[model samples]
Target: MSSDDHGLLPAELAEAARPAIAEARGKPARDAARILAEAGLTGVCAQEDDGGMALGLSFALAIAEEAGAGQLRFPLLDQILLAQAFAGQDIAGRIAAGEALGVIGWEGARDGLLRLSDDCDCDVVLVPTGQGADLIERAGLTATPTPLLDPDAPQIWLDVGAARKIGSLSGEQMADLRRAGEALYGGFVTGAAANALALSSDYLAARVQFGRPLSSKQAVRHHLARMKLLLEMSRAALARSLARDELGNPRDTRPAFLGAVGNAIWTLEKAIHLHGGMGFTWEVPLHYSLRDIRKIETAFGAGRLARQVAQDFIRAA
Candidate 1:
């Protein structure tokens, strides 16, 4: 079914997702999966026959934004994309139903080690190959946790030498996944920036110094204005990336993704600064948002990505 046939708009999907995402925030991976799947979020883009809404990536992008805004730790974005990518497969149906969990290794397999974003509590994992990706069973793999960035949900390095490959995505499919991933991840970081902006604005408005609201200061106002500007630009970039070009072909999503990550990093850092000393402490939640965006930036190598975009432009020129 088409997105229009679902009788639900993207905004409505976001609204419906907020509460579920909020509830799933601190839950275990399996529990969070069930909560999201029961809410129909995990299958937002999967085929209808596979117990999904069969909506477009735009719908999934909306849900992704909510996941980001809520600071959810589960790999919801990967799950959603995998469900859609492996449509009609049993794994897809299981994922849509929340009976199975999957995670993707952002880095390609190197020296038998596959780097993952979150904990390895999943049933299977997608590891990047030379041209495509391999879906392999998670059992029999050694998971080495790296929790420096996010202690609660540490990154993991999986030894996949003994992994059993169950499925494979062709190069074309991998390309499609990358485009969709950029768009969804763009929305994800954009949501984090939005949340950080809200937090900063509210904090500054309430924070009084010398019997005056901090937000009333011109410097603070300027910072807030700049944050708002960047947030809107990120949103606009994401929206444009998801749209088809004039010739009815997909636009390159890397620019949007890169812009969103950079903007989010700047916004989060500024938000923390606006909080003064409180921002640096664990008492404030601003650090969580900052860490989340930074993790994505590091994972994707934002500087390298920006350089690649520039190189593409130069070649075209």
Candidate 2:
């Protein structure tokens, strides 16, 4: 279904989300959560009874893009997914109301240790199980921080031995959550790339060398053109992934997600390259986008995801 079919345009939602997301940036986790929830972003896909807007994943995808572009540190994606996943539960209501925070262990299992996206200050974590997933209380788990990539917001490892199960999702619900995650994350990286492209383009246009803008150089122009091309393609791929096929079945999202990651990495790297010496410095914000995209790439195992997509195509052929 199209954005229009949802009775709310994605662009409109994105415009509405930008200010709130920007406000939430650099704030404490709970404060950010309050800002986002008040703006109706944390529960965009949740049930109305749970204090959500009761929208679909497409709306959430728009919000995710805004979050990514703003470099929001909070786990907005996890909050939205969990709120919807746990629909009728009090936890869902709490999450939607910004009274509680939730995160997901994107990798590993509940039997041992699970890997979360980042050092999110959360109240509960959803860990994978044999059937689906269990929402375990964070107070009961031990969190080990991995600050190699992003020291400000590091990846976290959780020891998962018999934490309190506050909620659960069936296998089907987990599958749905995964699909929505792919689409939302695709939107996210695309947004990050878009920001990087804008920053690079603006910088190049204004940074004059030899009495002419650096953007006037053929080689520099070529690089900017390629970045723009890839960014647009990634956006298109993400949009296509969110749409149903002609058979009215959900389209496979792996290709789009993988493609977005690769494209974002390339765009971010090129953006840094275009900035020359300043790109390597902490003063320039381009590296943050690069780091974020790389973290996502590592989390998803882009190489493995691409191979899986290829294998599926080969079998169908």
Q: What lDDT does each candidate get?
A: 0.87, 0.84
* Model 1 misplaced regions, further than 4 Å: 1-3
Clash count, one per candidate: 0, 0
What would the per-residue lDDT of candidate 2 be over residues 1-317, giving only the tens digit for each residue? 33333577867888999999999998999999999999999888888899988886778888888887887778888899999999999999999989899987765463587877674668988887777888889886788888988887887778888688878899999877877888888888888888888888899999999999999999999999998899889888888888889998889998989988989999888899899999888899888878788877766667877898899999999
Which candidate should be chosen as best, given TM-score against the real structure?
Answer: 1
Which candidate should be chosen as best, given lDDT against the real structure? Answer: 1
**Per-residue lDDT of model 1, residues 178-234, tens digit only:** 788888988999999899899899999999999999999999999999999998998
C-alpha lDDT (0 to 100) for residue 98 of candidate 1: 87
| Per-candidate TM-score against the hidden true structure | 0.97, 0.95
Clashing pairs in 2: none
